[model samples]
Target chain A: MSDAKLLRDELRKKYLEFGLEAMSDEEVVRLVLSLSCNEFDSFTEKLIEGFGSLKSIEDADPQALVRYSDIGERSAVLFRMVSEISRCLAVKNVKKGVYLRTTADAKSFFAPLFTDHREERLAVVCLSSRLKAVAPASVIAEGAAASVRASCRRITALALDLKADGVIIAHSHPSGKAVPSSGDCASTELLASALSRFGIALIDHIIVAADDCVSLRETDIPLSFRDRECFGYKITKLL
Target chain B: MGKGSIHSGHRDRMRSRFLTLGSGGFSEHEILELLLFYSIPRANTNETAHALIERFGSLENVLAAAPEELMTIKGIKSESAFVIRLMHDLCKRYSATSDVSADLSDDEKLEGFLTEYFSENHGNVCLLLDMTPRGELRSTKCLPTSSLLSGELGSREIAELVVRNGFVRVVIGQCIDGDKCIPDASCYSLTRLFAETLAPLGTELHDHIICCSGKCFSMRKNGSFSFGSGGNHE
Candidate 1:
């Protein structure tokens, strides 16, 4: 066999033996590109150099990927398809009936929902009394890159319709930190109080930003409604 | 109506509601009240439940509270406190026995099991899953830390554990605190090392699952890592 064929065989063998993670980014990219192009080593190097990383290449538009001399429409579309498939599978892997018992659970479930969205979006995960999710997350609102509004009435209606005992409100900060802004805090307080009146617990308000997420409940922001009495009994203040 | 009859009437109604609708139909305080009814008798458990929740901030915290701490509440005597503690213990026992024969080879099943296993666990910790040749989980052992880079638990120690227990198929799990479920370089290296070590001894390293923020990343399913010829035993 020729040198190129030998190298391809070696890469395939390593992948089967040690797995894709054992291979370098360049080797994995080259292996994928090799299926389409004969002369993929130099092309793979150029693509990596141009895109900076495999993740960036995956995130790149098909049109942008086709700008590379060696990459045709077929190759670019292949990259995009793989990325999209991975994302869909990730979202699907979030099984229903999973309990959102803690801030981390809420963050994990909501993080995947906000992936790849450049604009701000608000979603609510309705939970049963046992803290299990009643259904998948519903994107109730979408807005510009910076801000999105969450209507208390709409959220309450959805919760009532689903007969959810609790709700977790989440919104993405596409271009900003995961820290809740003043507006976010105020809106969360209002939403929490509004839901409380309906006897639906506000489990958490998560702010998802890229790969990071923060819970408003875990932060220093005090929620007054959280302290209010329930069942007609005065709450004994804890020291 | 008499005060005692009023209390008895309300208890009867609550009991009926509980039997018809189950615990999921009740609020946190209501559930606690129902549990307190058996121990506290005809007294108003609604007020006691409210007081318990208010003082502890949540029903979970109340149950987790010590018997001495529970007695601080007005109506929570020794019997009621024991009932609360009993509920907590019963939950723990139920979780432990329910999924003992779980098939770890199924990605979804493994993920669900790991999510629950690491729910109460905080910070980063390593877990070793010993499984039968048929992929049924045998037992799980939790390590001190998941930082393989720190040399806290070496591959040799894990290999020994597998050999000593005669576990033919094993899986490794780790719980990280952040939202990123993807394995880092050290994790990759550790998984590779573990697989290589176990492969020689006829032990299969099924998958290395990284549990983070309730999400599970399985190396075998993601095609990120492979071990033992990638054959399906199940």
Candidate 2:
């Protein structure tokens, strides 16, 4: 067998024999570098531990990952590639009408495709009549402030064009602090106000930062009440 | 010249005279006159402040305009303008750097960055930056929020960006309130609606922020309850 295959086989044996749970950090590092695919057990576990969990690792910054002793630029890049692939797959599945049940479930859907990125991103989650996510589209860079007008116009236009029933807005903070910014609060109100006039529903806004993601609805801000809508306006009850 | 004269009034008068003289490239003495505006309340800063304003324009404009704009005036030749410009650019770029990535999936970072940017603006001007999946910066556009009653954010505006530029992700940011406050239900609802519409196109809804004067709030922080759709992302 080739050296890579042989090395992978050897590591797999070690992983099974010692049980991956008991491996040392050094051993995990050595094994990660030797594996054919960087998605080895030790590498993933190391990434998870460093980031606190798979969801966090997926949301971590690439440069932060590179800072790890065993994770060089190459490994960091590879891991990011693997993570991005997973994010794409998750969005793809959701777009295919997959029902998302929990935040963990959402993380799993995106873990393969998005991880360790330096730039910010914005996406629109399109839903059908049943509230199932049917598709997601990137709304492009919203700048340092995640303002509503620009994002809302883009998503609203897209929703109108697609004749979608509803939409969700989600994005990540590379700073790894998922606490909502004031801008986040304002845009949420603006977008919701704008879409209310169109008969389309705005369901939620999600923030994905390092190791933690927060949903606006979970906060004390009254969300479900029509009388409490933003811009001093109420949206058409389309949910 | 009487014994009951203001002890330090002479300094104030001299400073104002210097300010007037400094209007044509104010000397050090003339510039010091304007610095007295805040320090010496009754002090006459007419000559100095006028000179400074002549050299730099109105104080409001001087502070509001870009440092590059400030440097265009005479007698302000120190690296201060460059420093000021650098500081402003750094702030913009720092926020921009927060979302720096070549991969398209990392676009959420960009969205987060912009949300904070726009949430701080009180005006109507909106800033939009487009990118490809390869992390290349694309075209930047400005749109008025009030005028966008009919304009929708469709893929056509970003078609070349996504296809030719290889941008798998995109983010949009702007500021409006100049005071970050909790978003209303409509905000959360609109974001969710957008996510649902864009799902088929393979794009993800990252975030929406309301930027106020000095603060920002992420809808996701409070919008999670409304999202309800839970699944593995990675």
Candidate 3:
């Protein structure tokens, strides 16, 4: 076999045995590029030099990737596909029937739904009396880049429809701060009161911004419920 | 009080408790007794439930018991056995539906899922995870395996399945009966054979996980095998 073929074979062997973590950024890029390009060694080197790192290469748009002399549409598409797959795999959904009792649980469950959203969005997690998620988190509202409104009437109606004993409200802020706005705090109190009149508890309100999330109940916000003693059976903490 | 009135009063209270407090309010025997109310009818199942727990050691084992094994106990007829089996199948169905959209690309998440997937079964089985190009799980298939080298699941058959399903990426999991998570030489050979067979078809074998007795060993993570173009072993 030729020298290029020998090197490619060696890399494939290493990947199959030791997996992706064992490979360097250049080696991984080379292996992926080799699948599409004939003279992949030079193509891999050129792309790496332009992008600077494996993460940057994965994040690079197809248009930017195709600017390289050796990288064609097929290679560009492959690179983008790999990047998209990695992202999808990374942000897993909170499965149904999982308990959402703590702020940490609420964060993990809500964070994935808000990933990569430029526009603000609001979601409600309907919980059973036992604090287990009764259904998948529902995206109730979507608005412009900076602000989204939560409809108290609509949220109350949804809780009743699902027969949920409690609900956790979450919304995304594209501005990259997990702090709740004054409007956020005001609306959460109103939402809590509306839910409480019907015997439903507004367990918590979470604000997600970029990678960070903050639970409003954990904050100094003075949001109070009419019947905090109702769903006091299974909820141990963060009630 | 007579037996009939006493049984009726107890049943009414149990039903009321379940409705008000859910499964968390009930003990193991109480849960089983509540379940048996539908199948057995009228008679107090509290004793039967206790007998089942004593025989099988736990509610999980009692539910997992074979129909014949369940019928070995007094008052557990075919109807009771059928209900018990149905409950077990229902739990499996619920778990499967809940986990339908699970992303199995992360090693730790994948291991946890595989371990739970194989928890009930003591037999050797091979699980195939058909994933989309975007790494989302499309479907999962579990096939019983006597051995890896057995003709039950050859590399050609796996390749055909991948091609038929149009799966761009896949994960193969082998669940052994015992607690040894280590994969022998046959496992390595099978991985290479699978990788080679699928590579030509543009389908990538993402990883081969070995799950044994609640523990999981990831071949891709540990790494020592090769799927070279030629027969050049490293």
Query: What tens digits encode model 2's per-residue C-alpha lDDT throughout A109-148?
Result: 3332234343476767666656566664444443354445
For each candidate in the order shown, give its overall lDDT on alpha carbons. Answer: 0.66, 0.46, 0.66
Q: What's model 2's lDDT at B86?
A: 26
Interface RMSD of each: 24.3, 23.3, 22.4
> Which ten residues in a row are the worst by lDDT in model 3 chain A?
A84-93
lDDT of 3: 0.66
TM-score of chain A of 3: 0.60
TM-score, per-candidate, Cα-based: 0.36, 0.30, 0.37
lDDT of 1 by residue, B104-202 (tens): 657788888888766744435556676654455654544434334465456666665556545556788777667799998877887887877787787
Candidate 3 on A18-68: residue-level lDDT in tens?
A: 756677768877876765567889988776655544544543434335543
Off by over 4 Å in 3: A1-61, A69-82, A85-92, A143-150, A210-212, A226-239, B1-234
For every prediction, compared with the true complex, DockQ reads: 0.01, 0.01, 0.01
Chain B TM, every candidate: 0.55, 0.37, 0.54
Once superposed on the true structure, which residue ranges of model 1 sit more than 4 Å away at CA? A1-75, A145-149, A210-212, A228-239, B1-234
Of 1 and 2, which scores higher on TM-score?
1
**How well is each residue in B107-169 modelled by candidate 2, as lDDT tens digits?**
365554555444432344334344433333333333333322223433343332233322234
